[model samples]
Target: MGGGLTLDGLNRQPQIGNTRLQAPIGLAPFNSGMFGQDGSIGTDGLSFYRSFCNDRLGLLCVGGLAVAAAGRANRSSMCLDRDERAHGLRLVCETAHAAGVKVAVQIEHAGRQTGPHETGLPSVAATAAPCPVVGGSPSALSLGEISLIVDQFVHTAEIAARAGADLIEVHAAHGYLLSGFLSAATNTRQDRYGGNLERRFRIVHEIVTRAHAAVGHRIGIRINVHEDLPGGMTPDQAIAGLRNLRTKLAYISISGGMYTRARDVIIPRRTLSRALWRDQAATVRTELGVPVMIAGNIDTPELAASLLEHNVSDVVLFGRSLLADPDMLISATTGRQIQPCTDCGQCKYHTKGYPHIYCPFHPTLRPLRSTWKRRRTD
Candidate 1:
């Protein structure tokens, strides 16, 4: 059943921020980064999300908003560090509420995956270990810096609450700052924030605790169940760490892989089998007994229905497929011709050279890139 899907919270168990969706399908905040230069939701970003809401999608996770400028994955990403940022977020809330759809703001920090050219400051991470893919010499964060970051996460959550966001999904996957602290391949520290699985999850625990204190039950998280790199986060470790947080969150969104193996992990290719993480999500649902959301090669309604029917995931997140075809949900429900996504890499955004995401097949839906400056790697 697509209706009445619930994501449990501490005080209010079995409720997704007190909102129900028309279906189990939702849009993943595909980091388009076409927001305003000041990291606010500009006209383009609002219109983009509005189009999806009009398509009758259940939930919409707005594009990842950096907690601070230094944590930005790229220059074009929106930010939630200041009070001014709330204005734009309010607009997004108004638009989604008008459409009777719930929206979540995905808050994130890039960590060592970003560089000074993009953030105008040295990238920071759990350790000095360079990102396996981005290959930047990021400075390891000190105790004071880590504390400040924890506060930033809390402050941003407060802003989201004030702006009327139904939930704030903390981005703890895809080799970002929180992901770095959780993975053994990247985090090799002896402090409380690193070492054993529980210790490594200290910062995240602090963030979640403080966020809940500030914003009640509007906090959720997306975490990697299994990183692709050697000595990275294992499924067992993920389950153990999530056990520590299963009660504090509104929901747990399961994802796999760091940026090191982005191809099949983050964005699976067509050749790979669909629902790559189906078993992982099912395991999480059985063990943690908390609501779970999953995404990966879930391109059609039939696949999504099967996952929900089998109790694999509570919500199904669609990424590139929706980017390729915005009216995908409507087309599927109304028995219309649904445009197939070829799994083409053309819509990948925030890459070094390519600054925007646009499907060549749907030229009219392509976001305008007139203001985006080409990123300089030299």
Candidate 2:
């Protein structure tokens, strides 16, 4: 309404690269702790099965899944490293695909943000820089090591494609290993991997190009369009940076915050407005002329409709809302009032550090969780 965009126009399916999504709604990736400790399939696939069974579910980004053992994030996250792990991923994707849901994984490396308890490997970053929030001095990665990491990204994409993943989201955001190279605060390397925009974004360029070559054009990239730190890249600069690499990527997903600004990205503090990055997403969508996806606190269907009506972005990704009510899209379409997410931040807390994620506001989803766990483990 505000920008010559109408609800009727917005309701139409938009093409992302060569793929056409049924609707603009997407399930954004997080450390959902829905996988096993060995980074394979978890027992919660039944819940996901029910949640994603509807035709209204367009695309789902399954993870900020660990791309390598060295970058293993938490104890119970999924990975694309081994054949056995891919088997679990294949089964999960098969289930989703059977129900008409397309799945993608947000492949990532934790960089210096990894915990010693998580991966048993020393954290590595672009310039031996330590994120202020993470609080550790990381060893600088050598050129050979950086190239190897890029190769691993290509290999991961190949495995993900074979595992029936419809798309691959290269996570270069939120202070991960790739984002470390993108941000000035975390990247101080004097070599080609740091300083200025092009050099710093070299790894991402290589990954997107190589991964797309390996897995076709179903490759996307997620980035922190806004970083509220002194030495971090801001949303405006990030837009320009992305524009430079626009031709390489299939789509661009706009996210914000870094490890230091975790509250804006991971936690989504109440002080911040819902859809906090709406305008930034619009800019990316307009300037770069690509399919743009935005996920922040934009949880409600009304807001999502309004965002599309105004041409804010191409896709609206709901995080905590899906956690609260897997049937949210059905409720929205049926004009039934959907249960809202309390946004207590508890789900994020539980998923990142624990193996189970349930919405306390919707406790009936797992009435006898203890029994469910006993059955799964036994």
Candidate 3:
């Protein structure tokens, strides 16, 4: 993302007040393997990003590794092999720190969205219904199961901390496990985890509270301020939930849409629109008195600066933009107007059916470039 400024322009101006973006531009977990259908390893994902960004970027490692088990096949799976996950995280932390950047990891659970073929466990939600995408009926989770899920989240946080993550972003958005409970549309339970916003938010609150107690100051949450679903939590409801966990949360990251149904619409569209939720984030930041980070299609440095200048958000979380160009943050801060992501969604398309994920737009990954080099030698 370019800021329309030359190196001199950035150097001459007063320093950007918030140092959050000065170095730490978050790398989305990218969900390599574990829960994703593609099943790529976190290490491979980290290696690709580290090489591209030269380790001068913060990363939010995606979490879908089950931390609890109910049976043999239900055991928590690791996204990366034990050594690989730890090594990759250490590499990310060391490399980023050397370049003066910070890193965070996002903790998530697929919940009812987990395919039976994928997780080997029956998909369970607050209420039983047909799966949103595959159209299979699901079972309602028992209260005992709910308690286990909370423990799983806490365990995930602990694992993240051990993985050398600087921050822990609870994935309470995108109609995932936590979001399912929060959304009246998705959650129809008669228990404490359902009903009104307060009750609906109990599971998330407990997760955040336990996460904070476990990880202390390095806890945050990425939430969907508006689910964009019928009967889903609105912006106001999201604000209240965040407010309820004010003391427990360090920062609140704002995002929108339902991941299960609107995956394509959510990532590409939101990733490009810089102004999508600036106002909502500002309002949440104001009311909750916590640092707010806004993610969704935010591509350029100028857009990020504008958001901060207007107090719309405290930080910008670049997802696809970073995928397109890992050095995006460097170029933005250094006043270089590098080529921005075209937002063609080719990266997503490339991974749609492949066993291994690669960015077709990434210059280094171009087969033609390799062929050209070989031809030159010939």
Model 3: residues with Cα > 4 Å off, grouped in runs: 1-24, 34-44, 52-87, 260-265, 270-273, 333-337, 349-351, 363-378
Give TM per candidate: 0.91, 0.91, 0.80
Q: lDDT (CA) for every model shown?
A: 0.78, 0.76, 0.62
Q: Across residues 36-73, which tens digit of lDDT does each residue of candidate 1 receive? A: 75546667667777877853567888867888888988
Report the backbone clash tally of model 2.
0
**Count of residue pairs whose backbone atoms collide, per candidate:** 0, 0, 4
Q: Which candidate wins on lDDT? A: 1
**Predicted candidate 2 versus true structure: per-residue lDDT over 1-378, tens digit per residue:** 245433343355767776787777888887665666454664555455446556777787787578888787666566677656776677778877877777877788988887565677788988876667666778999999999999888888888888888888998888889988998877888889888888888888889888877788889998887777777877666777777667667789888777663455655774678888898889888888878888888777777878877788888888888778878878876778787887676575433333455566544335535444321221
Error of 2 at 33 (Å): 2.0
| Runs of candidate 1 exceeding 4 Å displacement | 1-14, 261-264, 362-364, 367-378
